[model samples]
Target: MDPENAASPPAGITREDLFERVWTTPINHLAEKLGMNHYQFARICEALNVPRPPAGYWQKKAVGKEAPRPELPAALPGDHARWSKGTRLLAPLPKRVYRRVERKAADRPQRPARHPMLIGVDESFRKTRTDEKNEFLRPYKYLLPDIVASADHLSTALDIANEIYNALDLKGHRVMFAPADQEMRRRHVDEQEVPRKDRKYGRYQTGSIWSPRRPTVTYVGSIPVGLVLTEMTERVTMRYLDGSYVREDSKLVRSARPWQLTHSWTTEQDLPCGRFRFVAYCPLANIEWSASWQETDAAGLKSLVPSIVARLHGSEAELQALIDAEEKAAAKRRKEWAEAQERYRRQEDRRAVEQALSHSKKQLAEIMEQWAAATAVERFFVEAEKRLEHLGEDRREHIQSRLALARAMLGEQDPLSYLADWLAPDERYQTRYPDH
Candidate 1:
């Protein structure tokens, strides 16, 4: 069948006929017969210019009252009375449902770490700056490049990273650089694909939605936990739609004003570096640990280490409990369903037995009625037997044959004996059926 014809209104039903049906039946009930939702059916009626009864129509009819249905307005010149077949109901697009994440309670105070990742790093600055591009740092090559940080920021970042690494390392975890492979990249909570040119930016390109990163991979045993980073200087961005640029010095600013005026432009100047923080996350466990981005300096980053460790263990326990509860509920539902099926089987068996007993009684009554009728005819022939001597031979033979047939119908014994058990009925009923 063509899809258009399937969805179109039934053929031969005019606009007036549709109006009568809508006013007579509830819209929801009518819509169901048409294989449509109430809203969709209403839209179809609107398109056809069909009028409907107002909301209280059914309630008024229930009380032996009438509700006035609206008069259908005239359709425009191109309007059609018959609905054209369109696509059947399309499923609604999926929506993301946000759920509140459960966090572990912060009840116990934790002890400070004894060994951090950066504990043995050399502190001396080199006369000529060199990139930290070795095999150990290879995974981070495209992401966190070895751009030289200011002497102070570098010291703070290193110290923060050391404390966070040690906190995990002491608990049988490892903090290493992220692997460059796609499989490892997918494990990061903030990982996403971007255009090729955006790959070198460490973050997704401007105008795209992505958070900043100072990439390092954390591991619990052999399992990779995604990007853990130490926060450095704060940068705020102002985005706009423009094809213009800005330069710094007074003369450069004056020169750029004309271009800015010609084309609306925006600027995103970095703010002064503030106290550093550290962020630790385990994407597999859906856990994130970080002190306030603005509040944590080198010392504060070390303090949060204990809390982060405690929460990781706590989250694992909670997740297990949730799984156990769901399994128990599923088992309970299965047990209840089995019990309901058993009850239905017993009820059906009882109904079959009751129906058989009722039918047996009806059969027995019909047999008894047939026997009584045959007995009445036999008595009539008994009286007429003496009078038959004076009759002709042919007439007497005809009367005798009918009397024999009446005797045969009554059978040799009491009617009840012949019908003692009707648990199973006879193979076939008599030619002349009993009324009941």
Candidate 2:
């Protein structure tokens, strides 16, 4: 087997055999061969009950100044005494060395102390740092459609945004895409302690005309979290200055401007691309925002993610408080609105009552006038009947007929009954306008 890619530890290498491997080569070189850093290799040696070659052991061997090999220490119960992932075994290995490694499985694998996301982000960032375009774990198209990046120049911005989203999603906050002017009743507490909503149609529009597409935004619940992506580039310019073919006429040469159209490179640059920055908006929490610049490397960028997530989590309490305040304000406004409706209804009822009262009074006056005129006519007819009785039966009969006609014309219909109905207030109206 090639020593560089040894298959595995041979079956039966013991502590003494492992020490021999270290003593044969400088500890640093041996560590490189094992693909482990010198410090890590040293720790592994301490764990494995193997004594590393002492300082200068390699130095003496290099100069042909020999020293006796140090005795290998006995394996203690806590000491790891196996050639495992970090060591190579000699060809003539004991069959039992493999058994030792198998028995020491507990010491072979050590889980990293940091989160996996942090590790992956660092690695990914490093690989793509020099890339002109952004890199994503998966194709950009697969992400939620509502996230429309500013332009192709900021294409990779979504990747960083996704990094933030994933962190929050893992923490149980559901991410939602918010359309422009969404209908959701978002309440804000005003100075008057009233809850007011600024809801509008969410469909995109320009100049009062509907637009099919609009800028994308993120939301958690009704609160909008704005995502802004900006790109900066460096630019350069060149200019040429020529004054070649001039005869050395001393007086003319002195007046000639030699610097005109000089050939040279003129370069101007804006902010460096290496310092890409992003911000996370927390609208619910006093419109709070947190921003981070991409770190110098993947590891730095990875380190930045946690703090951004922390800031977001830290604002949860404030967000809840703001929501509560808004709810209370809204409730108050609703109560006020209901009261105003009741007032308007009462005013309408009172107006109705006043109108009916005026109408009934007018109707009652007409009825009284008709009743008076009928009474006067009946009295006159009775008198005529008594006087005419002495004259003749024909005259008396005519008078009596006239009197009967008059009585029939004035039927028993009471104007007062009609007047009463017109005067009586409606119950529905009175309930709202009791005084009327």
Candidate 3:
């Protein structure tokens, strides 16, 4: 009988039939069968308010198990709703009650404080030299590389601040900037002063030069560059340091590489008190060593203390000797550990090989037993065929069916592979035998 006409469809041909047919058939074949282009078929489904097939659905179905059909609800009598309402109203209150309880715990007190070091970076200065007329000077036109180089110096200062911030973990700390002098402030401020219109210089008015307009400067309170550095420093410090909080006594140090601190300006004549311009004093001894920024600034006038000092002072030779001893001890321990691991690995390999051999033996025995049983049945069939040489053709077919059933009982015949041919060959026999 034709499978299509085996039974009447429960419902009329609708979107569901289209979905099943479209889903079961390959897209190219389905499109050709419907006499429509692949894209047009998809559009038709959309017009019919049906969702299009998901990408790779065909490929997935080729490898996946058939999706289970949903169970339908049983038919109910007309009076079922009334009976349900009465039964539900008479039912006892549910005993399963969920209760949540709140518990109060005592808060712990703070412990003794630990010392953490405090570090700070000074405000950076930007110097731009202008022409005699006070107009903005272009560095390339004037061959004044120093002006461009000054920007690099500011960048170095910022980098130093970042390194300090990252090393110390000062994520949320505030960085305050105080300009060295009023001249520096005027140069940095965005807004310039303008003269007021009302004032005029006169001999009758005590001969003071006055302007009507007053100088006004605009102030924008943005988070300062130094504050950003401090916040980053706090973050880094918290990440590496122990305890919930940090204190000022933790050793703080900074070092400047490639630049030396010196006096930017000096007084022409010696006097009782003379102003000195402090700069980074980087001597050869300070190279590659971490020191404080504050110390570097003060190194010109005084001998600055070393930043990274151990608890005990020792000669370079003694320190090297200690390091060598520790390294030798570590090497010896590592050698011993390696030997232990090698022995353990060898033992595991032996055990694995033994287990594999045992499993393979068991599997070979089972296979041999099955082969022997199959050979015996084939011999029996040969003997039965010899004895039934005079049997009718119908009797031969019945005997053949019995033999097929016997082979199936012995787990020899695969129905899906041999009879239905529904499953792909690779899927059916990919793992016929287990790995040894």
Candidate 4:
């Protein structure tokens, strides 16, 4: 909220009157007169081509170092020079949508103690870094502990992180990087007091998500707790004009009026309150556990590390219970998997045995069919020999000679050979599940 633009009028002040009032009185007081908020009044001034005083104007004026006020320019051909009392502004965001609790104030610690891990990490962080939000510096190095803070607040945030790390160290809770051999996972911890909709839920943030090559965790007894330190961001109201939302003090890229471009919007950046938040979580997969502590205006985070550590120590029993449950669940799953494998094996073996039996029966049936056919051939030869006894002597001799030729022409069939070639069920398939 701009302090120069204050309580508006019931009849809606004219462009000339609005411009004079904006420079003369604070917007907060003027807005209250019209029963309007500071944001609505500020937008009204922009819509009417009335420029409000920049931030720190009132503060400077009090000290007699105020800058010169610019003359209100005549409206462009399409610009609005007058506003009605019930002037329509863009719809506001719901109260529930962006309601963030204000974080407590933080006071810096002088010559704050440094952790062993962060001793040389400062130089490394500076070696590889990127700009964030035109204000914050994000270091890409993951060897450093996960700490998210603007360049201005980096020293303070690091001091808080360092003190906490060493305090845990002294208590025998060793704050260190996760071992390479361990297949641990780190969860993204958001410290900004931004709404869910405004936040960018990306994997790569200012060391908030997958920034750590290895998770930074501390052992509270047998339970491992993943830790992250972040400088919390306060919700700042930004005006949207010329296709971007920026601070009131920032220059516009393009001269876009409220009617020409879109309306104002809010941002999740800090008008930077130096609040810090510390988060601890379970890094193990499928285990849902986390705890957080935020600095208050009354007490700084550096002074509370000992108490926070004690709370973390107290949380051990709860974490242990979750671990025990996970172990028991894993054992049950293993047992079930083994039983399923064994059951499938038995089913396959029984199927093989049944197939073998069926195959042997088919072979026996085929052999019996061949044996019956062979018997008929033998019967025919035996009957023909008996008939030879009734023929005349010469006829019998000729017939018997012809019959011998016919018998030789038709190959002799052996009935016993069919039975000898047939196999039993055991020869067809060997069964593993003999009981079945």
Candidate 5:
């Protein structure tokens, strides 16, 4: 047998061993030993089924010094050179690429905190005519509308006042309304306590018109807090003489006795008969009228009062219902939005897992391609060594030098030692390819 061909202990090697040895050495150092660029050596390491370490890892190890040449293992038989798809390897990755992947993974949304509450309020009203007639025998009318109209106006005003009150109350403040007239003030006093009254008695006024000697009655109405007062007045002129043609001045006749009815009195003054005043007194809180009340004027005022109250109640109820419905809708939308956010968070977690798996697979494929190419070059070195052993001593030295040159060109270490280096043990390689 040829001495060069003589069998040494066949290198005890497995694919896992080859992968670990090749993977453990830093790529830059391996490149220096093979007289190749770092990237070129990286391709060789990849062919040997080694995964790349991050670039920073090698750079730190080099510490600004020239990278050292890596040692190769002893040669093994061709049979020991088997490669498998599942072979594990360590490969060096570019620092930029690794950082980019890490950043992408971290760019997801985080959970959110709670927010504050939102609220709103609004008001509305309508007008209507009253049934009573005025002193001129014409239908009694409001400057705008009648009792229902006043009630509608009052209801709208109260609604607005209530909204302001609610807002102030939330902020620890108070609100109150005083009436424009006595009837409204009376109503207000009846609704609230004496201490709760916004204004003093006799501060507001109520007025009515009627035919002389006609029976009249007035109704005392209730008032609410926060009422704003405004003034109103009317005047009329009566002409008893005519001056159309002759410009004549007419004289009025004077009666010898202008008879006026008077109530009788005995030893002590007696009360007026069949004529009485109806006064509504509230002990809880007193209400003052700007104008005095007469017994003959009561009937007309009393007749209009109930309509005003009814209109106010209806309008208020409707407005309150509208506000309630709006609030309910707003609350419902908030709840739904919260649920949607939770679902979105869960979806993001699932996507992260899938992305990680895909990234790992892509990295593995790149390492495998590099390792396959390096293996082919190593086999060529093994063949050349066999042919070199057959030459004469002088020619053998020449051939050996040529073989050395060839190894350098192929970026290989000693063929025998390189094979042994490819079969070293590595824990990381074993873990990634446990089944192998």
Candidate 6:
């Protein structure tokens, strides 16, 4: 049967029809034809129990090598069963949620002098400027990988950042700046590794934390995970003196006189903690998800990299669910905006006709009132002239002069002129709509 004639299937696409289309075209390109993003389209395939071409399947097929195509499974009772472009359920097929797969940690004969993400990073993080109050590094370059630290911890921060980036590379997770073509988001990786809510905000905001123009992310298959390695903040007592803040226990504050202490006050603030933390988060703007591991007593943050990667390696299903829900909500929002625009347009069209009709009625009543007033004035003048005939010549002459002034005040009244300028409802507003 023609796919367009499929009665129960959405968008007139049957299960077999969708299966052929996915295999025939790369899923990414196929998404545009169906008016859905790649993830949304992938989800639809999953719902219909359709098997798709694996990554490199098309590449291999292009080289004339046989690429295996999996058979579509028999429909399950809960399956979406069929789909077409019009279907609301776009499939985000994260076909397999990551399972922890262990492999030999290949020892590089020599690790590259540095991972590309870390090249020139040390010089780039110079404390060219800083907030004296917190002593935070305000690097001139904000477009570095999301590694935030201080001058003293720069070397240690690089080592941990290099290790995680390279290790993920060896494990087949491509860690780097997010691809421009992908829709990705970065969580504000604060200087402190603490929960974002608990992290204190201040005038300097712990001094401008470095952020990359694009997020630093890794793709495990089609899933993109964001990474941030930052030094956590420590709470300490700060003393405000004549002009600046200094550590309460510092030499300057400790050397203060009794009189000086009387004017000074101390308050607790978050300074750069010597410790570091690694955070992994879902980088979709519509999704809120993250996991973090900071320096522990027994281990440094470097040792925690593998566990962080492993956790991301396993949380695929959870992130996929969040992404799918967001896609559906976005579609709903677009639909609502379009409906609101149409409704408003209809209301404006109807309002224009009503306003014109109301204005015409008001003008008609005004003209009739003016004509009555003009008749009254004309009769008064006529009656005064006849009464003057009965008075003496001297009295008539004086009264006639006053009547001339009154006529000037109400001069040139004509109902014909008002009628000529009058507009009917049809003339006032010529509607484009069909007549009722």
Single out the weakest 10-residue window by summed lDDT for candidate 1: 132-141
Native RMSD of candidate 2 (Å): 26.6
Error (Å) of candidate 5 at residue 156 is: 21
Clash counts per candidate, in order, are: 0, 14, 35, 14, 45, 8
Q: Is candidate 3 or candidate 6 better by TM-score?
A: 6
TM-score of each model, paired residue for residue: 0.28, 0.39, 0.24, 0.53, 0.24, 0.58
lDDT of each: 0.48, 0.46, 0.32, 0.71, 0.33, 0.74
1 against 2, candidate with superior lDDT: 1
Candidate 1, superposed: residue stretches over 4 Å from native: 1-152, 177-182, 186-215, 219-224, 232-267, 284-299, 318-436
lDDT of 6 by residue, 88-166 (tens): 5521312223345466567735433467777766776884566454555768776678887777777888888888887
Output the TM-score of candidate 3: 0.24
lDDT of 2 by residue, 89-149 (tens): 2112112112122355666864223222222332322332123222112222221222212
lDDT accuracy of residue 347 in candidate 4: 91
Pairs with backbone N, CA or C atoms under 3 Å apart (clashes), candidate 1:
none
- For model 3 the local lDDT of residue 201 reads 18
Query: On residues 258-352, what C-alpha lDDT tens digit does candidate 3 reach at each position?
Result: 23212121111111111111111111111221112222233521222122111011223443454466678778988999999977876666666
Arranged by TM-score with the best first, the candidates are 6, 4, 2, 1, 3, 5
lDDT of 1 at 247: 28
Residue-level lDDT for 24 in candidate 5: 55
CA deviation > 4 Å runs, candidate 2: 1-145, 150-154, 170-172, 177-310, 349-360, 398-423, 426-429, 432-436
Question: Which residue pairs in model 6 clash with each other?
Answer: 42-91, 42-93, 43-91, 43-92, 43-93, 44-90, 44-91, 185-283
RMSD of 3: 35.9
RMSD of each: 30.9, 26.6, 35.9, 29.9, 42.3, 12.2
